[model samples]
Target: MGLEVVPNTREVLIDLYTKTLKEIQVVPEDEGYKKAVESFTSHRPKLIEKKLGCGQVEELIEEAQDELTLIGKMIVIEEKKWLVDEDED
Candidate 1:
């Protein structure tokens, strides 16, 4: 979507984004990785609203890193069913 990824020397934001997607293959049938995908995707619209002057890349990367990390953690849990349980309620 937008540029929510701007990895700096100390940040692995974009790297994490790609890695997360790879680990959790975002598909419709399985909501496991889907949950993480939604989180990463949710920021797309908001990020699209911003207008950066080439100085926002680092910040964007930092932000993307945070979002991607969470998704990565979700993948590690391997319990998408638990996430679904909350939705059922």
Candidate 2:
């Protein structure tokens, strides 16, 4: 099946990646998960810019969207854990 083409894929992906990077700050910097996320999230926009300069990015856009969703969920989970830890103290 073919993926639907977003009218503004470049702008949308940049926004998503930017938001993901910002949201990921909730995770502790020392943690591997945060490091991994920061590593990729920081590079994705540059990659997208390079790719968009040459050709299509429908696949990349979809991937960015998926990552954004995951980031949102992870942030929520981390916040919940923090709340639990606070309550226990």
Candidate 3:
């Protein structure tokens, strides 16, 4: 089956990528996760600007959403870590 075209794929992707980049700052810069996320999140927008094919753009959008989910999980884990540290004090 063909992918259904979203009316605002570019806007959606930009918003997602932007939020992901912002949220990822909570992660330590030296961590591989942060570096990997920064690399790909920065690259996806260029792909959009280049006007990649619909299938490729859709794939990027899905990947962006997945990354955002991962960022959320990372933030939660960090918060929990902080709470545990405080409790041990």
Candidate 4:
């Protein structure tokens, strides 16, 4: 018996990452907010590479990255929807 690897670690990280992204309320007009998002985006790849490991770690990283992009797009769409609602109200 050796060290036990936790199952679904990648999924857990993805959940947390997506939640964090979703909770961000920064608009595109703010340069500081853009830089903050950039910082998080820059670290995501390295964080996934370091924390999650399996036989096909590279493939896992790619999959995680794809999910991240989807999450980002979803956030943007939701924000736009909210802005429209606010304008209507």
- The TM-score-based order of candidates, best leading, equals 3, 2, 4, 1
- Backbone collision tally, model 4: 0
- What tens digits encode model 3's per-residue C-alpha lDDT throughout 1-89? 75666779889999999999998998988889999999988887887888675456667778788999988998899899999999999
Which run of 10 residues does model 4 get worst, by summed lDDT? 52-61
Give the alpha-carbon lDDT of every model: 0.55, 0.78, 0.86, 0.58
Q: TM-score winner among the candidates?
A: 3
Q: How would the candidate models be sorted by lDDT, starting from the highest?
A: 3, 2, 4, 1
Best by lDDT: 3
Clashes counted in candidate 2 amount to 0
Instruction: Kindly list the per-residue Cα lDDT of model 4 for residues 1-89, writing each as its tens digit.
Output: 43345476566556655655554444453656555655665467566767533445445445545655655786688678999999999
Query: On residues 1-89, what C-alpha lDDT tens digit does candidate 1 reach at each position?
Result: 55544335233544555565565564444565577566654444344456544345565565666656766675556567668888899
TM per prediction = 0.38, 0.73, 0.80, 0.39
Per-residue lDDT tens digits for candidate 2, residues 1-89, read 88888888868878877887887787788889878878877877787656555336777777767877887898798889989999999
Q: After superposition, how far is residue 4 of candidate 1 from its true place, in Å?
A: 16
Question: Residue 28 error for model 2, in Å?
Answer: 1.0
Give the RMSD in angstroms, all C-alphas superposed, for model 4.
9.1
Candidate 4, overall lDDT? 0.58
